[model samples]
Target chain A: MGESILSGTVFAAGISVGPAILPGIFPLAPLLAFNPFTEPVGVIHYMIVGAVMFTAGVVCMALKRNALGVLMGIELVLNGANINFIAFSSPYLRGDGAPTLGLDGQLIALFVILLAAAEAAVALAITLNFYNNHATVDIDRADDLKG
Target chain B: MTGTIRMDSIFTSVLLHLPAPTAPVVAAVDWHSVLFLLFAGLACGFAIAVVAAENVVRMALYLVFSLAATAGLFFLAGADFLGAMQLMIYVGGTLVLLVFGVMLTAQAPLVSIKPSASDRALAGIAGAALLAVLLAAAVSVDAWRKPGVGEIPSPTATPLGMALVGVRVDDPPAGAPLTGRSGYMLPFEIVSVHLLVVLVGAAYLARAKRRKTPRAIDVLASSDPPSQGAVLAAAVPAVRTTSGAGGKSALLGGGH
Candidate 1:
């Protein structure tokens, strides 16, 4: 009886470990289960991409001392948000009977793009003025107002 | 031993249960997902590149590619007008403005100001946290995870134009609770006025200022030890002198 119980426990462990080890050997195996290339793309995929871009933009904004780099970061952040908006608006990407933003999403994205352009223009003007006065675009050195 | 035999049998059973890698299935590939993957890869890759790049010009270039890929994504999502506007305004206009800014301020010392290690680490942590939260939120909704029906809606450019002129030309989506769709004419006018104000304000802020006395920067540069700022300040007078001559010629030309 003791031997049978030990054998059963060992069998169970083997069964559990086999699948885990197989994935390690064939890394793409697990990824292929979802098979994005074969299946249709969804809003979730766009959201993931937007999330990555947004993160990168935030990091760029935080890490760059150059004023123009910060401005670029702002652009990336805006584009990321625009992607989410477009995805939400897309009728093709909606689930069965799912409510979509329809034209409103596209309109909002258009406004965002326009505003981003305007913001960039104003921001560039500000950066140029700062550079003209201080002869440096390093934002850290813009300490004249600091008490 | 009996234990070893049992383990071997279990492994065999597990392998049998696992589906064998059959011949490549000639299934119909979804071109939409392929294009989406391509554009998403380009957009995300270049966005990360923009963050990782050290040179200002390279960052701007990466930004252009990233924004262009995002435009492609907008097109894929059926926002054709938005995509065109993105290409024209974002990739064409704003990026050109950005590149000009980079060139104007591309002094040797300012081109690549690497953040301190501590700042980078802190920002990395914060960005990672934010991304985790966003991704969690994105995938948390079961409805959002459902595969799309992949039906291409009709072109919206005409309806969108009509809507801008205070008319809802297109029918609302099925099951939407809203009864009457409002026109966007008011917001459109507001944005137009806003753009005009921004244009005037930007022009005013960026206009050249002719200072009678030495500017604070020049004063500081002259007082401080010899550095890039002092060198730049020394060059500024030469530029001003040349510009003065050019301005006189322009006035002469205008008189003709």
Candidate 2:
């Protein structure tokens, strides 16, 4: 458990630097301007960042054999989508008047969060049942479902 | 100290870029952004840590931090109700179930499950590629690069709450009002029911095994004995029981 907490702190520190580091990789990053901050915060930039995070989550989901790992991946994907939704709703990145999903985007993100919780509960229960029967959490052993 | 400019006004005035006379009511402070960054950073970081950690309980701990951060982000984003729901439901309720499951499944020998190095390598490669592609797509969209339509709009909690109840409180500037803006009453109701079913299902799954505990004679006469985690405490000399922080045996379902 200590290892997990350590990793969480490390990963958060990494992600915290994302907004600061991203501009270096994308030269055109400065051209757009939606941010209300003294700096240039653009919708494209936010969306792009969200997409990266989402993509990372998908890969994590696909590769993890542990049920918990898979759940973590789902979280990453949800967070990525959330970043996009918020970026869309933010006035700092978009111009004075543009089409937006508006409150609907935020609402959708909220629903996604709530449902994610429900999904976690159901998944955790199923995982426990699997362990009870098989004495392990290896998803590979669940191949009986293929039959 | 006398020259101290209020932090909120300094930010609002500079960010708004409007002359004092012409500027709309610029809040001395927008507490939202300050709080938003704090939570967003916490949630995203802890989530990543959960992926790297090997210990089940530690992973659960990280999950708790991540969810808490996400809840804070929700509030900062002006979804106060959603944020509160996130705290009460996901962090407090569902996560507790997850922890219980973790406790049940973590047998004496299998608490910290580490992934093989090869698997980690493959996942890292795939994750990197996916991140690259998504980042490229995000940068390609030109419209998203400009200031949004709702930029600097008034705080939205009331309108959002009313909208959830079936109202379109804010009119779009210089455009025909939106159509089919039905509030989220239906989805809200559905979520409540979904939660109820999940609660019942989790309870049933976690119920104590109905099969009777092995009879006392079963250990020496018929059944393998239960591990002495509880009984061993009183049986062993007190001086020998503790192995301190580095002791994995302490975590082997031992009450101590």
Candidate 3:
């Protein structure tokens, strides 16, 4: 029994190591090719970071019960989009002599920040009104219109 | 054994002939990528923390850190004006307002309302799918994956300012048709008016009003379990009266 168990362990190790040693078969090999510390970052790097933030925001919006939490999620979503705009607009990030988005991207990001502030103010006001009316900030309790 | 000995002898000879160790070869660190990593890690980590944290105040705090780090990213990307705007308006103005809203409504049972297990599972699945799609799209673009040219452009504040007021002082890029680029003066005016309208509307919506009779919420509050009900019942009258009186005073002051 001990010999059989030892053989099974060896087999399992082999199975795990086989794909990792092969070039194309390794799943993470593609990702490992680019080293961010040694190589300069590009627009794609910023987009990936933005994507993570955007996902977290969507999850927050979907899962949170507090109105303010939802509002925070909205802010996160806007911020993720803003990062993309900044990355695309950056002259440094463009390769092959491509024309960057120039001032337009920064200008749009500015407007997004401005609009986000306005939206937050209005949303907070609406939330306050809802809180005063219902005496609760739990969105689940907002069922008066649910006919 | 003989073949192994022969291979060992050749390997030793190769090692002995190698150049003597002198200055250690250190790989040059790209400060831009290092800073990008630092800021991106902070932003993404805190953003996830905002989602994971149960406490409302902690979530707000995490959001603040995330946004501040995002401002650092903007600075790293060469948008000095936008970065400053992000710090002043987003972290300073909007987050402060959000915190105020949180403080105002954070009664005991409402501070951390845990979502149901099913809701969390569903949202997790959906968010994972969305992230996969977005990341795939982001990485699939070959042009975007190419390393940047590392050329820092001139300051954009002057051009941005000029463009906002109907002047396009910045030169067009090489080989680009310049005739179609339009100034943002029209949108700037519209945004200004929109902000004014939103300011008034929010104030109007949040104004305290006197009620002739107790509403459904008041009845519900009174019927709640004694511990929570007593606290809410006591707090409601105090808050209502204070805000109401304050609103009346403000209106009177405006009249004067």
Candidate 4:
């Protein structure tokens, strides 16, 4: 049994060593410690990621001429906020005495996801109607309502 | 006593002589962090890709990847039930949106709508500033910087289920009054009703409409034949001016 365990250990080590060495081959070795692989991640890391996605979504909404593209942006923005809620509520991501949100965060995220789906449905229907009327899906031409 | 001491020393020596265990090396990988990195990278990358891509179909596809990655993030954060819900609803929503995009853009002219270069530059600058502010705020929270508990929380599906029905089965908020906290029953009911209304409204809005032009067959079927001819002559000019590429009369060529 001991012999089998030792052999398995050696085999696993051999496999892991190859990948670990390959990452070293990259020029970013000096920044290896800062990599998420080397350290335990926390809520802040998740928050930063959420921020990036939210910003991307905002930019998408602002720049995309296609109505569907704008809808996609809105989805991204909602997901970003959902990430933050989950991260904040996550017990695993909370340190001792951190006053975590417990189930509330997840609850809010759940509602957000549901509402987002509903919003998307209504928005898509509107976009289709707009396309039917105007013969285009570009938001730029949606100025029929403009005063 | 001497014999036991000698046995202990021998056991220690045996452990020391054997190859150091590989447990540390294995544990060092931090699979949680690795998965977090993988999911977060994909989510953010695909979101940006969705924004950058001009083709609506490609943007929808990228949005799928981004939302799927987000679902993975939810799972990592220990919201397994929410994660699954996100996957099911969000992906279904995306699929519906994709169908709409395909249907509307089947007329090849509408496939890609490129925004002006000035618009792109302005949006980029605004996005950057917003990102800077958000990142600064996210990092500035001192309590949030503390390392997490790093333990799998007990599954929360049951408590969440109860909570939705107006029961606060989970732990109450810290330092709150002894009076029991309220649940989400009100909002739940409201959303359910709202969704129903949205469904009906959307169906009404998207239903196929009769073409504006009076078809020749329809005119022949009408009792007032001479007056129909006069009506067609009067309508033709208006239809010609309004219907641009796919003129209304031509669209009715194949009876719906």
Candidate 5:
């Protein structure tokens, strides 16, 4: 019984090891290691998703000449940060006895969403005004202030 | 139902014959990871699509889908109230933006604006570098990789509501002796006021401006420059708003 319990604990700990380094160790290593398909996810997985979204947002902002496209990028970036906050705040996603962000993270995320909304509204309004003044929404053409 | 019962019986029999120790752990599928992957992929993929698409309307549509997927992720992460709010407000914002897009694109000349290929390449390279840095930082943390305690906490919205009104119902973890966790009452009130201000300000800025003279473009296009100022002043009636600013009267209708 003691040996069985020890094995159970070992299995639980081993599941946390990510699948990247487990290729040749054991025949069933894929099942044992932390692949998203087989093993339960940790906070790292959520961070990865956030990072991808943020990168896409940055690319969108830098490449798009349309002012609205840039606004979309800003929203994506904010949403990425919000995802990180939610991951940290979730009790089920925290380590055993780990000092977690708890409610603080969620609260911060909520505020971020609210502020993002306000920011978007103001930004769209400004975009509209810019379009009116220049008769164009092409941000590349808005060079009136250029020396 | 009968098929499900028969399948369950077969599954039970197979499980009974297998090694007892690892059976429970092995059979349990990680639904959370599956859901996370699904939502995250949709969100990221649509975001990338938005970046790549040159058509303004298509970009707006992609953004709406991306944000909706993000709300799915929020729900998966257990922020139920936030997920709902994200759905409502983000979708509403997208709708307003879509209307703006339609309004702007009603004019045939400015429907799409494409960036040069060189700009796209440079932005892609920069984005990749940033992503590498972010991913490395995220993965380098040891504690964040650890498996969770695997227990669902109580509903988040009630305590969240309390916290917004200057009351914290949830206690800090026993191991960490934290000082009093102050609520977000101040920030909440401040944000509410800020939102109101933003709404009024946005309306003001976007409002049509009336000018007695023709638009700068029209003035520049005409040949005679000596009497341009006089001609503009006499061209339009004083009572007519002339689409507030520029020549957007056709697109915007009467200036509101």
Candidate 6:
């Protein structure tokens, strides 16, 4: 029972930390004395991770009938992009003097965020229009152009 | 002996006590990175689930979790101010707005809205492809992969604040210290204006929706006169049938 709950939370839900997994996979106690303040090894592995959020967001936007679902997709897409931008700007993660984006990446990310907000507003406006006219938000029904 | 030592503090000692082969894995694992990894995975996973789940309320919940995790990612990546901004603006402010919208629009029992299975399959494939392309592009470069990023001193929030006005604060390398780092003051101002507009717009959209009757409770109250104590009597199911039998529209007309 313990194993079932533990495994469910860890792998299925993606809640368990790597250290916990390591301790389970191998056999060792965590370094409680290893002060997190002192980061000897920097942020290489952080960038390599392909965010699953981005893909999920895409699927939602494409498949869902609700306007909110589409909006969530946009947020997810932005989040995925954000992971990259942050990884690039993070001095702790990048090589020393490796022509990293530094603050530029963050600046670009900020623009993307602003643009995304604008897009959401415009999309919501359009959605409200559709709702007023048709009384439903199902995009599939928006086939007046088909005839 | 175990009582004398806290289990976590004795990393080396704990390793000795545990079985072999894990020594290498334990030695390699960095706890600092572990925190970020867990949070990031959560933000990503819940986001996907939000897309999959049909319930709007549940979607909002997932979105809340995802945004919170992103804030954690920001702090972990050394964007402390940005992280705080994310929490304040994205989570606290924007999410509340989203919930309000959900509640308002949730008419007719407000339940799950399922899409076609074929649509789901197609989107899943498309999303998977996009992810593959993006992931491939992100990790393909050599500079990001093994950056060997040296010790970067955590900069003060003061400098970041200063640079928002168009000052390049992160130490520039060259003749005449490049003065072009634009402070974020302009964008911040713009975002403030944008949010104000959004608030006015959302309020305008939701104001005083016309309904046939005020409410179930109001309809009952209006049927009985206060002088005759009919208001109190109106609560009885027997009185409701007679008063309400006149048709709900008639009761509302009698209110005036």
For B210-244, candidate 5 gives per-residue lDDT tens digits of 56656555444422212212333333333433333
Per-model CA lDDT versus the true structure: 0.79, 0.60, 0.80, 0.74, 0.72, 0.60
Docking class of 6: incorrect
lDDT of 3 by residue, B138-234 (tens): 7766667677888777788999999999898877754345667889999899999999999999997776544567665565433222322233343
- lDDT of candidate 4 at residue B138, scale 0 to 100: 79
Local accuracy of candidate 1 as per-residue lDDT tens digits, B10-116: 66557666533547544455678879999999999999999989899999999999999999998888889888999999999999999999998897878898988
lDDT of 2 by residue, B6-100 (tens): 67467656787654454454442223433544565676677667767777678779878877776665554445666677678767877786777
Whole-structure CA lDDT of model 2? 0.60
State the weakest 10-residue window (summed lDDT) of model 4 chain B. B222-231
User: What is the two-chain DockQ of model 5?
Assistant: 0.36
Best by DockQ: 5
Candidate 2 structure quality by residue, lDDT tens digits, A1-147: 223332345344644465675675564444432122223344664565466557656865776666766676776677678767866654444544445666776677777778888788778877766565455665654443232
Q: For chain B alone, what TM-score does every candidate structure achieve against the true structure?
A: 0.71, 0.59, 0.70, 0.69, 0.68, 0.63
What is each candidate's DockQ, to 2 decimals?
0.34, 0.20, 0.33, 0.31, 0.36, 0.16
User: Which residue pairs clash in candidate 3?
Assistant: none
Per-candidate count of clashing residue pairs (backbone under 3 Å):
0, 18, 0, 0, 1, 11
C-alpha lDDT of residue B99 in model 1 = 99
Candidate ordering by DockQ (highest first)? 5, 1, 3, 4, 2, 6
Candidate by candidate, in order, the iRMS in Å equals 10.4, 10.7, 10.2, 7.0, 6.7, 11.0
In Å, candidate 4's interface RMSD is 7.0
Worst 10 residues of 1 chain B by lDDT: B221-230
Task: Quote the positional error of residue B175 for candidate 4 in Å.
Answer: 7.6
Cand. 3 Cα-lDDT: 0.80
Task: Rank all candidate structures by their TM-score, best first, as comma-separated numbers.
Answer: 3, 1, 5, 4, 2, 6
